[model samples]
Target: MTPLLVAVDVGTTSARAGVLTRDGAVLARAEAPIEIRREGAERAEHKSENIWASVCRAVAEAIAKAGADTETIVGIAFDATCSLVVRAKDGAPLAVGSDGDPDWDTIVWLDHRALAEAEEARATGHRVLDFAGGALSPEMEIPKLMWLKRNLPKTWQRAGYMFDLADFLSWKACGSLERSQSTLTSKWSFLAHEAEGWPADFLTAMGLEDLRERASLPRHASPIGHPLGTLTAKAARELGLPKTVIVGTGMVDAHAGALGVLGAFANQPETIDRHLGLIAGTSSAVTALATEPRPAPGVWGPYFGAVLPGIWLSEGGQSASGAALDHIIRVHSSGAAPTPLMHAEIINRITQLRSQCDDLAPRLHVLPDFHGNRSPFANPKALGVISGMSLDASFDGLCKLYWRGAVAIALGVRQILETLNARGYAIDTLHVTGGHTRNPLLMELYADATGCTVHELPDADAMLLGTAMAAATGAGLYPSLADAATAMRHASVTREPDRSRRALYDRDYAVFLKMHAHRAEIEAML
Candidate 1:
């Protein structure tokens, strides 16, 4: 019987599962939306039970569609948003909100409810803060835990375990509490690069020493193919699979994308050390693998054994790329109303508007930090700045603003790459995948701005492919991630920078830097 691998990817908006053959071809795929609830300022929550249900549904649908025998599916893996999942003993939900509802057990990654707490934590001048790009944002796990202690003290006291969303799913499926170094070290401030376990002082500072007391921290929390027990009979029934399926340690969604593609360069004689994986999504992340650890300030990294078994992974990105564009388009125009035309129609209208533009936001450049700056300058408090806007509020003008905003974001990616290049990393090529990768104009702009050859995976769903790669490793079809990526990953299209527009962008990017610097000066004066 031909072996199959099943991968469950739980993202910010939905849960998805894909079944892939040994060669990395997707045989079946399924998705189910996960609900989000917001109660104003920085509060975003998802029900843990609902997320699990969606995962089960997506997995069942994909397996049924593939028509593969349950016994033929050799392994399972997962990837999810770096959201924080808190639960009480016996796996009961513990509210992570101010309203004190036990059902709200999750603090969605996008939630900024812990902003003040994050600021406070950063103000302490903790040495570990340097690892998180000099300033830690509330989007990370530690700040959320601190916020829980400070604001939701009762729930904090009741909490039995804290899990990054991916680890939580792994725990749910195989009943192993081992957290992946990818999520814990990258987002939770766990010290994975060093021989030391999680920093005791850091945990003490966050008042999460109880976690250490329970000895939940793993000695070697790096990503490994753990025979993490079996799919619980209960979960197996829900997913319509056999209870004996093996599960493995999983990674964050974007990290999985990195794993899926980074290995594609195997045996090509190109040094994989300098290759950077640009995984763009609602947000953008830069994942790079290196032989020795190199810590780039304002970039989160030197994560040990996060992706490849022995290589260090450095990750950095804008908190809002796709999200930023959506925000700019909505706020600059007539609210979030869907255009009378379809999405393609609206995109065409925008394209036409851009053709009529004389200059790229001659008087207008947006900072694109509406959410928070996640790279190079990890300042969450940095408010967005839109320089040089007139009183003209026409919809067409608004569309132009949107175009400028997308370009500005592309420039931010450039700024990040510039930082990396200066730190002795050679980023020669860009590999992109996600919902945003479908936007050809945006892809071209990214290539032009960064001056790198941007390649898109042939498979529309690379994250699914990535998770399946992990499962394939567990199924013993491939000896390593590199081997699987070579057979499974291929680039269907490539976008090169347009030299004709290089001079224009070169000037515009300088202005982009000036606007941000000038805004900082302007704000300081106030």
Candidate 2:
């Protein structure tokens, strides 16, 4: 019997598990939604127990669906959001709430309630802050921790372990406390580009020196491929699998998407130098492979061994993409609660209506940075701006504004690519994967806006496939991540930029830039 590998991807909204063959074919898959609750601007949280339950359910469902011999499963790999997870010494949930129920322990990555703390840390001029786009936003771990320390002092004092969601999942399954280089270097300011461990002074400066003594953390590549002992008997039974299955170290969810696609393309003869991976989901990230580490001032990383091992990665992205679009529709409404079904239909109807216009309209321009800018200029205080809006309250008009926002996001991506290209990083084609890729208008807009062809994987589950590939490696089926990607990844369609829309986008991009600059001015004034 052919051996199978398991890949579990824990995302912001869902947990997915897939059973796959050595050659990259997915035999069965399962998905479970991860609950999210947002309190206010930049405040998002998830229950750790809920997340773990989702993982177990997804894995069990996938195994049952595959109908394969359970003993054939050789290895498992995991991936999840870079969100922060806090637990007490005995592994009990430690609430991070200011005054709500004392059960919320997970701080969703989108949570920016730590903005004040992050800004204060930035003002300290810590050298470690340079790796994170020259400024640390509340999105990273330390600031969030600091917020907990100041706002939830009692909880902070009692907390025994803190983890990036990806690492937390790994620990839960195999009892390994090793951290991924992808997770620490990208979000926790761990030095991957350098040969040393975490900078002592940097931690002290950020008022997080206490973590320097933590015993559970492991370096990026040190504990990389070791089986974190087999899945615990408890985790195994919960997942409906044998306890002896090997569990390998995992990666950040987007890096898993990159590992699933870009890792493979980097080795290909045709797409090596300039290929970029756009993982568009709740947020958007632009990932590119680099030969050596090169830092972009306001963008994240030059993270070594973060995505594909040994190759450097420079990541640029919008802090909000799909979420921003959702916010756009919600707030633009005068006095209406847009149901999920209604909201989606509104977007579709708007998209179809926009298709009827002459492909050029001056009545819409939207700045979708409602969650603050995450790339090119690491300003977390940046606000969204809308221009060219008429008094028209029609849904079609709303859709046009929505499309303009999407187009503006693409333009922002182009700006990052331009920055990278200007600084000597070559970007040739874009390989995109994620939930937003399902939108034809979004893909076309991105291609036209960036003047590059957009290639999406045929599988539609690149993140899961990426994790599965890692399992394939741990099972000794593939030599490396690059090898796994090539065998498993398949391009379904390529969307090329249209010349007619190119000129219109060019003019519109200028206005987009202007609107952002004006917003900055207004924000500073306030």
TM-score of each: 0.91, 0.90
- For residues 1-526, could you state the per-residue lDDT of candidate 1 as single tens digits? 9888899889877999998887878889999999888888777999888999999999889988998898888889899988988888667889887778878899999898888878877887887775666667778888888777778778766777778898889888878888887787778777776778578787787677776433255666846444566789888888877887778778888788887778676444237665668777678888777776667877877677777666777788888887776776567544464333423454676777667763545667778888777787776666777877887677666666777787888899888877877776788678877766766658878888778888876455767777777777765677776677677775558878877788888988999899878877987899
- Distance from true location, Cα of 34 in model 2, Å: 3.7
RMSD in Å for model 2: 3.0
Error of 2 at 402 (Å): 3.4
- Per-residue CA lDDT of model 2 for 1-526, tens digit only, reads 8888888988778999999888778889999998898888778999988999999899888989999788999889888888988887788888876655546789998788988888887888777766666777788888887888778877777777889998898888878777777788878888876777687787777677776333245644432334566889888888777887888778888888877768667476333548888888768888887777667767787777787767777888888988777777787753145455655776677667666775644757878888778778887767778877788777666677777777887888888888778766778688888867766667887798999888876456777777877777666677776776778776568888887877888888888778878887887788
> What lDDT would candidate 2 get against the real structure?
0.78
lDDT (Cα, 0-100) at 307 in candidate 2: 73
The worst-scoring run of ten residues by lDDT in candidate 1 lies at: 337-346
lDDT of each: 0.77, 0.78
